[model samples]
Each structure stands twice: as C-alpha cells, then as structure tokens.
Target: MSHPQAKIHRMSELVEPIATVTFSEVPNEAFLALGMRDYWDGYFAGRAAPLGQAPAEVVHAVFYNFADGEVARHIPWVWGKITPQEAIAVRERGTAAALRQLLGPLVGSPGLVRAADLATRAAVSAPTEGRALYAGLRTLDVPEDPVARLWHAATLLREHRGDGHNAALLAHGIGGTQAHVLMALSLGMKAEEFGRVHHLPRARLATVVDGLRGRGLVNADGGFTDAGREVKERIETLTDELAAPPYDVLSADELDELTAGLEPIAAAARGHDD
Candidate 1:
C-alpha cells in the first residue's frame, strides 16, 4: 500500500469536485435564502477565522473561494458573529441539495453508498486537530439524509484538511498572495482564476510575486523554483499528515473503492461546467 497519509489524501482528492464544482455551481439559492451575499461573507469569514479573529483579514483569506467582486460586495457586512451551526446549516442545505441533484439519477449505482460511507467513517476520526474553524463545524449536528450525511462527512473532512493546510501555510510564514501563487504553481490553477477569487490589486500581487522570486521560491516567469517545489512538497506532506486521521478508518481496498466511485461522479460534475 502507499503511505497511509498519501492513501488518505489520494482518496480525499476524489471527493473534492463535489465542493469545488457541484456545490459552487449550484445556485446560491441557499445563501440567498439565508441573506445572500451577506451570509456568504459571514459564513466563510467565520470558518476562516479559526486560527484567530479575522485571521488573514476579510479580503485575502482563502477558506472559501470568493469571486473578484465578492470581497468588494460583502466586506462591509458583519463578521465574527456568524455561529458555526448557522454556517454549517447553510452549508449542508446547499451541499445536500446540490449532491442530490448531481448524483440523484445514479442512485442505484454501485459504490455510491460505499463512497459516502468511507467519508462518513473517516470523519469520525478527523476532529483531533486544534483548529477552531474545523472544531466549530465539527460540533454541528450531522444530518440523517443519506446525501446530506455524505456531504456533512465530506465537509468535515474538507474543512479538517483545509484547516490543516492553513495551519501549514501559517507555520511556513507564507502569506495569502504567495499561498495562492503556490497553489497555481503546484496545481496548475490560473492567475486569472486566483485574481477572480481574491480582491487584491495586481500591483500588490506583482510585488508578492517578485518577493517570491527574490526568496527563490518562484521563478521569474511565475512558476515554482526548485526551492519552492521542495517547500510545496513539504507542505503537502504535512497536509496529508493532518488529513490522515479521518482516513485511518478506511482500508486500502476501501480507499480504492471510494476513489473509483467518485471518479465518474467528479467527471459528471465537471461535465456540467460552463
């Protein structure tokens, strides 16, 4: 078997498209019902503030991938007051509805329940990390609906992993712009996509890019330097470490089963991307 940590993460990635694509693309109807952009802002703000109040400030924090206009649109709204249960409720409604829509047609498909079961079981072991954002969400009551149960599990797992990633970023002294840039370098995310998600001006981003090059973490043309690659690799290794607690529940064959189940579902979700 691969390293336990790697196997855990390897299965984790299989479930990510549900959030990035399905949950994201599904109407903000749930958020709208909760107060639209304000709820969106407050919900993400609460989750991102796990480490400290306004951990990286409202604008540049990466807990949720807000759009370019998102920061400008919602920054003035009240933050730090949104409760974790409130956020989780809103999140679960949207995610559960979206998954039901996306995966409903194939309900009889083999391995779906097994896949969700893997996530749900993994979640039982994931909350040991000392991050408030994750810990807060962890405290929410889980749903009984099958899809909602799966999404809840996936959410716990995602946030748990994300909290760990944020912890790793902070520990390495990496800031927001550079952190996003590192994601672009390692994951092939586009600068335009990052720009859309972060409200920072180009000049500020350029300065960060230049500094990354100066520090030998990025090349002149905005790719990873060898040193940067090493750092990125180390961060991923640690993320896997933090993320592994949940997946410890899954056997190697089960991990493979979950991955296989999510593959087609992820592809199906991506198929609808516009």
Candidate 2:
C-alpha cells in the first residue's frame, strides 16, 4: 500500500490547476482519492467527464510540463474557498516554513531566506502577470496583410520561453495581455494556433488580430512584424531581470545539502517520477 503521505501529495497536486482555471466546483475528500470523478460528478453533474481531458492530464501538464517540475506533485491540496492571491500567500507561507524546517542551516542564512521568500511570492502571483503580458503583445507593429498580422501577433502571444508561469509572474509587474502573448510565443505558436489553445471565439480572435495589426504588433498574415520582435526581446529581458536566480546566495555545497532531504520528499510526492 502507498504511504498515507504520498497519497496526500498526489491529491494536492491535482487541485491547483482545477482551481487555476476557475473550476466552479470545489475539491473535497473524494476528489483527493479517486481523482476528479467524484468532485466533478457532484458539481458538474453529467457534463463532467468531457471537462477537457482527465484531471490527471491537466495536473501532469502543470506539475511536469508547464512549470518544469518547480512545483512538486505531492504537495497537498489547499483547503478553503480562496482567491488565487490568497492561495499564493498561503503556499508561500508553507514553503517558507518547510524550507526552514528541512534546510534550516542554509535557508536561515542571511539573504538566502529573503531571496527564497521573494521567489515564492513572485511565483504564487503569476496570473496577474498573465494579464499584463497579453496586453503588451497587443501593441506590436502591424503588417500589410490582415492574416499575416494576426499570425504575427499570435506567435508573440504564446511564447512560453522559460515557462508560462514565469511569464505570468513577470506580467504582474507589466501587463496581463503582454504576459499571455509572451506565453504564446514561447510555446512556438502562430496567430491561429494561439486562438486554438486559448479557445478564442472566432469573432473575438479575429477582432484581436485586427486590433494588434493596427497597433503594429503583427503582419497581415498574422506573424510578428519587426516591431513585434523588439517588443518580444524587451519582455524577455525584463523577465530575466525580475526572475529569482536559482539558489540565490547559497553556496553549491549548501544547496546540495538542502536538496538531499528535500529531494526524497519531492520524490515521494511525485512517486519517483523525476
């Protein structure tokens, strides 16, 4: 039988993305055990299964694919009807506490703990940035052809460079729209492709393309114009500047020591999936 703690970790990873997308249904005990079936059936009723892939897919996408393993799959689902901001705050507190407990000698050192605190805060506050990045992408130079312009804008919009969440966090300091666009671009999307991923309605997507083209962010064919490239580069630079350095202020040995205990917890949480 799986350890009780391992099961709790899996359940926790499952809850966030469901919450992230604003799932109206609240997660409960059953949801934590057999997955979303119980929760969705109770809340979404008959229409729950088709809620865009199983909860596992979405969870895997977030924990493994999107965040690139920054968030462990084992952390328990946070209970309570809380806003994203509140959720982030709660997570940060927990992370800080955990680090202090697990890696006290290193994390408690001057500057390191402060950096860790800031990094956690930035990550938890990503959705705000998502909105900002989306907006910034709207201002790129327009191209002659309408379709080309749309494509151009679309490519910039979906850039998921370092990670979409990171882009979103950076967006908090910038604009959501800009962050969304950067996320699109980093993911290597064209304008039309972005529409599919974001599920933009036909009329709305078309209008956005037109508007971006008008603002010089895209070409008639829906691709980034020259100005769009400059905007993308600028956003990337800013994102790098704002992001926390890996292991900030910690010596290599210190970081390794810290990771030794934390890694097992992470492995146990992720079921050894790396």
Candidate 3:
C-alpha cells in the first residue's frame, strides 16, 4: 500500500492543474469584462478576493512567492477596479466555463459528482489555523454545481497545501527568492526563464543563486548539490505531512475512490493544455 502521506501527495499533484487553470488558461476576456486590463491585476485581485480587499502587504505575506514589491504594484489598485465579490464571481464563472470547455462530457458525469463531493469533504475538514489563504477561501459558500464545486475544492486544497509549503520554507530558513532559485534549479529550468516568470531581475536572481551556492545548496551548473537536493526533499516531505491532515477525514477506500475519480479529469485537463 502507498504510504498515507504519499496518497495525500498524489491527490495534491492531481488537483493542481485544475486549481490553477484560472490563472494560467482563463482568457483575458474574463478579467476584461470587469474592466481589468492586465492579467496580473486580475490574478492578484481574484485570488485575494477571498480576503476582502486585503492590502498589498497582507497579500505579499500570504502569497509567499512573488518578488518584493511585485504584489504591491497591482493590489489595492486592482481592488479599485473591481470589488472582492465581483472578482470572486468572475473567477468562478470563468473557471467553470474553462473547465466545461476542457472536460466536455466529464463535467456532468456521475464520476465528477462523486469526486467533487469527496474532495469538498476533505477540504472543508482541513484545519484553518495559520493558513490564511485557505482560511479565507473556506469562508466562501460552496458552489452548487459539480464542476464549480470540484474546482473550488481543488482551490481550497491547493491553498491549504500552499500555506503549509510556506511554513515548510520558513522552517528551513528559505526566503521567497531563495525558494524560487531552489525550485528552478530542481526543475532544470534556465535561470532567465524562471526569473522572467517571477519578475526577478537578473542581478537579483544571481544574488540569490550566489547565496545558495555559498550555503553549498547549489552547484556551479545551477542544479541542486547533494545537500540542496536533501533540503528540497525535506521541505516537500514536511509539506506533504502538513497537508495530510485534511485527507485523514477520508477512509482509505474513499481516498482511493477520490483519486481514481479525479485521474481521468486531471488527465483530460492536461491533454487539453498540451
């Protein structure tokens, strides 16, 4: 049998793409409908809407990955263009439309309904302490539609795990830039590409890389050194452990059923994107 933590980890991997489709694939038109012109504007506003007009500093603290000042540039400003409730509505409608286009008949299948029910159970049962994003999301009403429910559940679980991940990073003494550097190195991504994605300047990226190299975490070739890999593994393992409590509400068989039900849906989402 898979380790219980491993099963929870698997659930996280399966749910990630579905949880993030709104950020990655949802059309600009969705945000445009609210008079938001920039993607990041919509992204910061929509995701943080659960927190009800949270300030930039609050967003930066919870988001945990953006470069310094990156969040401040959009937030508060985004709130001016759209209210938190409006942003939430746009995110839900857009995400639902996107899932329908991607999942087709799977959207209405009994399998989806079962998976949504199971995932929502686990999500709602998760502990909320110190998980600001997840706690914020949990306060919202659950969607009545299966597709929307599944998507919302995925988001809840995603943010729950993400908040735990931030804790793991903190426990390891890893700052946001340093964490991104470690991630890029682990994924074999070019520093330039990762830097562009996170809006880190080349010099700033190099500085963080150099700091890691000083700590013997990164090698000369920009990959994780032996110690670096171990640190990364430890962080991921702890993150999985922290994320496992929610799944405890499920019996072993129910966990299996939830994973099985989500597999095809996640695969369909992947295929659509690919």
Candidate 4:
C-alpha cells in the first residue's frame, strides 16, 4: 500500500502558502471591503486593549458588527457596549451606506441600486463546494509552503478514498468516523472498544474497522499500523510547527488576557477527532 504519511510529511515539510487574506488578517480592511465601512473604523475604535480580549471579538470585529462592544469609549475606543442584536443592526446600516456610496452612480434608480448592491454582496459572499475544497487544502500544514503539494494530496485522497460520508463529516466540523476509529486504535482501543466509543453498531463499525486494516490506515487487532502511527505523529508535529508563533513582547498580564479568550476556541479544536 502507498504510505499516506510519506506524501503528507513531504508536503508538511514545505512552507506555508499565501492564502487570500482571510477576514482574520485585517479586520478593518476586510470588513470595509465587504461594504461594512461603518464597522471600518469601529474595529480600531472599539477598544484600548487588544480587541481579542473579548470572547468572540475576532468573530465580531471581522465577521459581524462591532456594535456589540459593551464598554463605550471615544472615537479610537468607540466600543459598542450593547447586545449582539444592536451590534448587528449597526453593522447592517453601515454596510448599506457604504455600498450606496460606492455603487450609487452606476445604479441611477434608487430601488434598482439597492437590489443591485444586495445582489453583488450575495454573489461575493456565497460559499461553494469548490471553495470548501480550497479551504480544506489551505488548512493543511505543508512544510515549505507547498500549497500545490497539499492540494495534490487532497486530490489523491478524494479520488481514492471510501465514500465521502466520513469526509463530509470531517468538513462539517464533526470528527470523521474513519479518523476517530484510527485515533481510537492508536490509543489501543480494541474493535469492541472503538465501536462503543463511536456508538456504531458492531456490524457497521467492523466494516470500518476492517476497511482501515485493508487500507493500512489502521491495524489488525485494532492497533495502529506502522503507517497509521506515523501519519498521526506527523500530523501532530505539523500542527504545532504550523501554528502562529506566540507574541514575544506580550506582557504576562496581556498574554493571560489573550489566552483567556482564545483558550476555549483552541480547546474545542484540539478536542476534535479529525
């Protein structure tokens, strides 16, 4: 059997790729470009502290409206100290105004202008299967930023793998059954034990268990096959290596504040089976 990790490890050893600037990169620019100009200044204005000090600040500052800031402050610190709903309303109004300003000339008629603006926004923001596949490719930790290699691996896996029900589960933020089974076996779970943890019926789970054995993604007797173990270890190593470096200049107090808000998100991600 072809070793999956050999390819993944080669890919992982490459550099991080230049993904399109996600909303997480520049909150103000992204929001404004998305026609949320009112939220444009709101990001920087919302707080004296590092905005991430608040839970969901990343989501709100970039993806949603900043009108949810609870503690009110000045122009530079213009935080919205209100409910999420209020913040959303403020964001909507700001976005509408910005779109009107940008598109007003082309859309001479006001009614048509509004419809055209909404249509444009929808087209820009709509998600697609290809985009999801692209996002998945972007998430892989390639060693030397070899995005093409990672894309190749994903392509290979998709073409050769079992039915995508398990893969879809992984994409949906649920752990992949196959991945979970591999993990359980890595942890030395017997077939019965693995079945129990997954709540799979003996017959169905055994089919997965046997499938893993055949693909060399798991092992007989429910232990990690050599290939399986290597893949899991390399993935863990790559995850740590690929994570953004901690800020060097952060004060102890500042670090604590940042961690407090981010800890939960990290924990939830780590706890994911896939």
Candidate 5:
C-alpha cells in the first residue's frame, strides 16, 4: 500500500482538474459577466479574491510562480473592475457549471457525495499556519450545493498543497522564474512553451537558465544536472510531507474511497480537455 501522504498526493492530483477548470477551460463570458476584461483578469482576481484586495506584490509573494510584472498587470486592475467577493462568486459559479458539463449525472451521485465529505473533512482539518492562500480560503463558507461543495473542498486541498509546495521551493532557494525552468525540465516541457505560459521573455529566461547552470542545477543543454534532479526530488518530497497532515484525519479506508470516487471524475474532466 502507498503511504498515506502518497495516497493524499494522488487524490489531490485527481482533484486538480475539478478545482481549477474555471482558471483556463471555462468560457470567457463567465469572467466578462463579472465586468472583467478577459480570462487573465478573471484568473488573477478570482484566485486572489480569498486574500481580500491584496496588492500585486502580496500576490506575487504568495503565488510564487508567475514571472515578474505578470501579477501586476492583472491585479489592482482587476480589483478595479470587480470586488474580491464578487469575483469569488463568479469563480464558484463557473466552476460548478464546468463540472456539471463534465460530470453529468455523477454530480449528485453517492460516490461524489462521499468523496466531497472526505475531502472536506481533510481540508477542514488542515493546519493554516504558513499557508496564506489556504488560510484565506478557509474563511469562506463551504457551498451548500453538492457539486459546488465538492469543488470547494478540492480547492481547499489544492491551495493547501500549493502553499506547502511554495514553502519547499523557498527552502531550496528557488525563485519564481527559476522554479518555472526547473518545473519545465522535470515535466519534459519545452523551455519555449513553459516560458511563454509564464510570460518569461527569452532574454530573461536565458538569464534564469544561466543562473541555474551556475548553481550546477542545469546543464548547457537546459536539462537538469544530477544536483538539479536531486533538488527537485527533495522539494517534492518535502511538499508531500507537509500536505499529509490534513488527510491524517481520514482512515485507510476513507482515503481509498476518496481516491476511487475522484478517479473517474478526474478522468472525465481530462477527457473533456483532450
């Protein structure tokens, strides 16, 4: 059997698509209805809403992955268009719509209800210390609707793990741009592809790559050196350990049920994306 931490990690991965479909896959109209300019604006506003009118620098610090100036472009500006509470409402509604479209009849099924219950229990049990995003999200009430409740639970767990991941990256002394480069290498993504996604200019990306090479974390060919691979593994392991405590509230059988219930839902969401 997998360690409880490993099982929790697997379940979190399965829940990600449900938790984040509104970020990219949801229609632009959902955001536009909130008086936002575009999806990027909605992205920044919705994700940061829990932080309650946070400035770009704060978002940059907590989000810990976007390129410099990326957060600034959308934040404060997005706040001008819509308040944080309103943005949260739109995000929740959009997520429910997307999940319904993907999940169909499974939205209210017993399996989904059981999974939501287990996930919510774990999320509520998670520690808030050192987890800024999750801590803020915990302030909001869980939605009453079943599909919305499931999405809410998944979002809580997602942010909990994300907060832990950022802490691990910080401990390893990785900066935002550098973290992207390492992630690309770890996931076998092209530098150009990942760089573009993060709004990293070619020159800036080259500088980050050169710095990683200086630290013996990257090779001349832009792949991970032995040290780089070791660092990445260590970071991931630490993140998983940090994320484990929440699921400690669940027993072995409950963890298995959560995974089983979410697997098909994740598959359906992935299938829709494909």
Candidate 6:
C-alpha cells in the first residue's frame, strides 16, 4: 500500500505539468496571435492518442473532469487545429531543444535517457489488459521522432496514472465534491478555489459533507476526521498501485538512473514555472 505520506513526496513533480507543459512558460502574446486551437495543438501535439481527432468532450472527459463544464468546451476547436504529423514534429523539436538546454552532459546518455522514457511509456504501449485510460490512449499513432516519442510516451503514462486514480476514487464511492474537498489540503488547492473550478454547488457539497460528518469521516468544515484521513490514505495508496505497472518495466538500477538523469530536466521545467 502506498503510504499517504509517500504521496506528498511525488506530488511536487506531478502537480504543475498540466499547466506548465501546456501553457505556463508560453507567452500570452503568442497564444493571442496563434489562437486557442493552435496553442493547444502546439502544446498537446505528441501523445499515444490523437487527441486532435478526439472530440473536445472526449478529451475533456478523459483529462480535466467535465464536472463544472468549463475547460472542455474548446475540444472540437482544439482537435481540428493541425495535422497530427505536423503537431508531432513541432512537439519533438521542442522536446529536443529543451533536453539540450537543461540536460547538458546528460545528453551523452541517450540510451539511458531513452530507457527511462520507455519505462514510463510501458504503461501505454504495453497491452492495456486492465487500464481503461491506457487502452484508450494507445489507439493513437506513436510518433516517429525519438524525442517526441519520449514526450508522448511520458504524457500518456502520466495521464494513464491520472485516469487510474479517478477509477480508484469512483470505486471508493468518493464523489467529486468529497474527493476535491479532501484533496484541497493534499493537492495544495484552496477548498474554495477547487469548488469554484469544479463547479461544485455548495448545497450539493453540503449534503455530501453531512454524510461524511455522520460517518465521522469529516468535520463540519469538511476537514478530515481520523477515519477520513485513513480513507484518503487508502485511496491514494490504491491509486499508486493502479499506476505502478509502468515503472515496473525498468529494473531498480535502471529506474534510478533514469530518475537521476531526468531530475535536472524536471527541476529546470519547474524553474520555468517559478
């Protein structure tokens, strides 16, 4: 079981990618000039899935949950923005450039780097016997360029893990309101902000809160009760279990080497956000 405390260590690397990799370092002026679809096309180009061909709703439903109905509305517009091949090329160039800039001497370790990339990609490229999201993403064509393949591979794996988490959440009967409410502290999101973004109605949340309170799972403020904390920990541990198969593709030593090589790049990427 993944200890709840264990999750805290991993989140620093995961939380920002949806924003940074998508648009954080990107200049607002560029998006204004290019338009939304072009911006997204550039941002999301390489993946195991042709999200470009996917309806916005499909992409939104899979990615950003459609609960509040806010972010996914732009999907159709996003899908038609560019050819999959063009988008893949654009994505690969960007990854190669970033690797050169951030990795420095580590660029010499291309085989090791590629192995690291493949380890994570295994989640998607391998048969999705049980993964709902991985199976869906695997339908898209893999990129031919090595770097783009790496980028796409990592992303699909990341998202596959995310989807697995959602499934775990559902299996636990933790509704969206309770899940986000519980995650506010865990995810570093303010409760009010999370509620707003998810479009969770206060009244609905109140009812859920009441249920949790009755179960001794939460307090009046929706803070975790001891039982609540235990439940949350279990859910997180299960999520990690569901997401673990991909990393198993690498031996312990190989995985460590990959993490070491990627750490500088990941840190640099985080620096861009900071």
Task: Report the number of the highest-lDDT candidate.
Answer: 3
**Residue 206 shift from truth in candidate 1, angstroms:** 1.7
Q: Model 6, range 78-167, lDDT digits (tens) per residue?
A: 445545555444444555555444445545467535634554455454547656556755766666555445555665666666777777
lDDT of 5 by residue, 1-274 (tens): 2355667679768878878776656735688876887778888888999999989999999999888788899989988888999888988988888888888888889998888888898888977999999999999999988888888888998899999999999999998778878889898875667744445567878888899999999998889899999999999889888888778888888888889989988887765466
lDDT of 6 at 95: 51
For each candidate in turn, give its C-alpha RMSD to the true structure in angstroms.
4.3, 18.0, 1.8, 20.3, 1.8, 4.9
The global Cα lDDT (0 to 1) of model 4 is: 0.36
Report the C-alpha lDDT of model 4 over 49-128, residue by residue, as the tens digit. 22233444443422221233422322323334433333333333343333333333432444333322322222222222
Would you list the C-alpha lDDT of every candidate in the order shown?
Answer: 0.63, 0.36, 0.87, 0.36, 0.85, 0.55
**Residue-wise C-alpha lDDT for candidate 1, range 35-62, written one tens digit per residue:** 5454456445434433333434443454
The parts of candidate 1 lying over 4 Å away from their true place are 1-5, 38-87, 108-110, 187-193, 196-199
Candidate 2 lDDT over 1-274, as tens digits, reads 1223332233223222211221222223323333333442222211122122224334333222222222122222222233223333332233233323433344434343332233222223223243333223233333333222222222222222224445534453323333444456556776446642355455655665676677787778767778766677676555443332322334444434433423433332232122
Model 5 worst lDDT run, 10 consecutive residues: 190-199
- Indicate the worst ten consecutive residues by lDDT in candidate 3: 190-199
RMSD of 2: 18.0
Local error of candidate 2 at 21, Å? 15
- Candidate 5, pairs of clashing residues: none
Candidate 1 total steric clashes: 0
lDDT of 3 by residue, 134-217 (tens): 999999999999999999999999999999999999999898888887787778885556753456667888888888899999
lDDT of 5 at 97: 86
